[model samples]
Target: MRFIKRLIIGFVMVIILGICLYCYARLIEPNMLLKKSYSVTVPKDVKELKIVFFTDTHFGKYYPQEKITRLVDFINEQKPDVVIFGGDLIDSYNRDQELVNIEELSKSLKKIKASYGKIAVYGNHDYGGGAEPIYEKVMTDGGFKILRDSELTLSDLNLSIIGYDDYLLGSVDPNRYQLPDAPFRIVVTHEPDVIDNIKANGSLLVLAGHSHGGQVTIPFMKGVLRPGAEKYIKGQYDLKETITGCDATMIVSEGIGMTLKPFRFLNPPNIVVVSLKHK
Candidate 1:
């Protein structure tokens, strides 16, 4: 009986510790982002441009509109030449039109800025109850170009930015996009698993954000659950020569929202600032 009591006490202590750490990381980490820099080794001669990529802002019961606004403030301060959102921007699911989660986000997210351009795709959570229309509208009103398995070229730099439709939605053919003979090209998607969805010529770099870094990662065990991605489910990873031998840098941001339980343990919301220094 004494042993069982001890075990229960130990478990409660651990939970307390975990919550405390998450709060510290989120509230005090000045920069909640786990920043990464990558060099697009391909296409050799383009001027370097910095990009701030982030994803998965499941702003609902767990995270709110005010929380996302805080994140937007941090990201804009980075002054990225280009900004990209990987996916899962909202999480209301449309079951209730009266929920203020998605609606508030739609109103508050128009404050972000990107010099070259801002682009994004939608995630599974962003498909229901008119989430897409509202999300796309908010982004467009904010001056961002919403890419739906489409590409746009920033004439000033000639870089083509493409957005691949979420694989969970339907089929995506990477071949549809003809990478222009430009200096740089990039692709944004919600889940990193879409690395296989690149049936067409892939971009120089791909950004994603569906795995919340396991949300509540443990000391020696994996997160209680996985949002997406099976292997190397940490925060960031580099997928070199794949089964197809195509080489493009792949980055998976840990993301800035919580899901299921709405409490993050070791995983803090990220606001990544990626500086592209191609050599």
Candidate 2:
């Protein structure tokens, strides 16, 4: 009789715990924001640069547009020289288009100040749900240069930034586009796995987002992998041999928003601050 009683109590306790976890994941955790920082070494002659990178902010029903104010505030506090947005500005342009305020969104984005310039690339979500035109217009209105399968050279900083189209929805033919000759190069993309197809002779730094760190990570297990983010999910990876047998360092952000799932457990929204220093 005692054994049965104890079993019943244990079952009830488990049920209670589950309910608590569900509430936390849904209400408390998703709103939490985190800041992740990384440092990279550049050539001696290259000027040091501070770059703030963020992505995967599915700003729609799940992620409210008002949160952009907080995002811009957090980014400005970092005092970045260059700001790079990885994409997915809105969650679903088709379903949530009417809900978003383009004018206010553009105003908040414009407030984010970057000394050198602001750069952005398309994401899978950006091209999905007829979001291509809206995404481009918003970023451009916010003073961002949208780079699609092209490279932008900052002669003053002697730095080159290569932006690619979304691998899942947009064109990403590395063979068709020529790489810049700048001594320092930074590549930005929505999906990290695209690194496998890019062929560069020298070392490069790649920044990406879209994994959302599984959106709900469990202990001792890997985060849920997305179609385009199978190999590289989150954090930093050093690849000795890429497409052209060149070395590259990649940092994948967890991102600052949610998508299909509205809850965030262990993985919260985040922005990455990269400090590039002279070697």
Candidate 3:
């Protein structure tokens, strides 16, 4: 009799603990935002630059558009010289159209001030769910220049920013166009795994967001990794031996929103701020 009673109590305790974890993952963790920072060495002649990168705000059923206001404020506080968005802006444009207010979203995005410019690249989600038609417009409306398999040169800084198309849904050919003889280069993509395919020479820094740092991470076991984010889950990776064959560093942001499961465990949403200084 006592053994059965103890078993029942243990079962009840397990059930209660599960409920508490569920609530924390679904409610508390997802709402928390963290700011992560890193520093990179550039040529001494090049001017110092501060770049703020954020991405994967699914912004549909799980993430609200209003949060962008707070995000913009947070980014502005950093006073970044260049602002780069890694993509996955809207979760599902088809289903979330009603939930997102275009004008408000654009206004908030515009308010995010960056002296150099705001650049963006496409994510798988941006090309999927009927978002292609309006993704460019939305981002452009918000003062972002979309780089699809293209390169942008910042003459004064002697820097080149190359953005590739979504690896899964869009076309990506980093070598399609010849990059200028810029001393510093920054590559932005939605998926970090694609970095191995990039062949940029010289000092390089890559920024990506898609894994969400295993949105629902567990203590001992691995967290969920999306299709394109299999190899590089999150955080920084020194890719000196990568296919790029150049000395390079990559920083993958955990991102600012939730997706498929609508829950965030050990990993909280985050924006990455990178400082580029003379070597």
What is candidate 2's lDDT per residue for 1-279, written digit by digit as tens? Answer: 999999999999999999999999899888887889998988876689899999998998899998998999999999999999999899998989787988888889999999999999999989997788788899999999999988898988888888999989998885734553445589998999887776675668899998887888888766688988888888999876554545579999989888887888888889999999976
lDDT of 1 by residue, 211-267 (tens): 777777768877754434655354545555552444566777778776566566677
Using Cα atoms with residue i matched to residue i, what is each candidate's TM-score against the true structure?
0.79, 0.95, 0.95
Model 3's C-alpha root-mean-square deviation from the true structure amounts to: 1.7
Give the C-alpha miss distance for residue 214 in model 2, angstroms: 1.4
Off by over 4 Å in 2: 176-182, 243-245
Q: How much is the lDDT of residue 201 in candidate 1? A: 42
Q: By summed lDDT, which 10 consecutive residues of candidate 1 come out lowest?
A: 28-37
Q: List model 3 lDDT by residue over 88-179, tens digit each.
A: 99999898999988778887888989998999999999999888988898899999999999889888888888898999999876575344
Query: Order of all candidates by lDDT, from best down to worst?
Result: 3, 2, 1
| lDDT to native, each model | 0.67, 0.87, 0.88
lDDT of 1 at 21: 79
Candidate 2: the clashing residue pairs are none
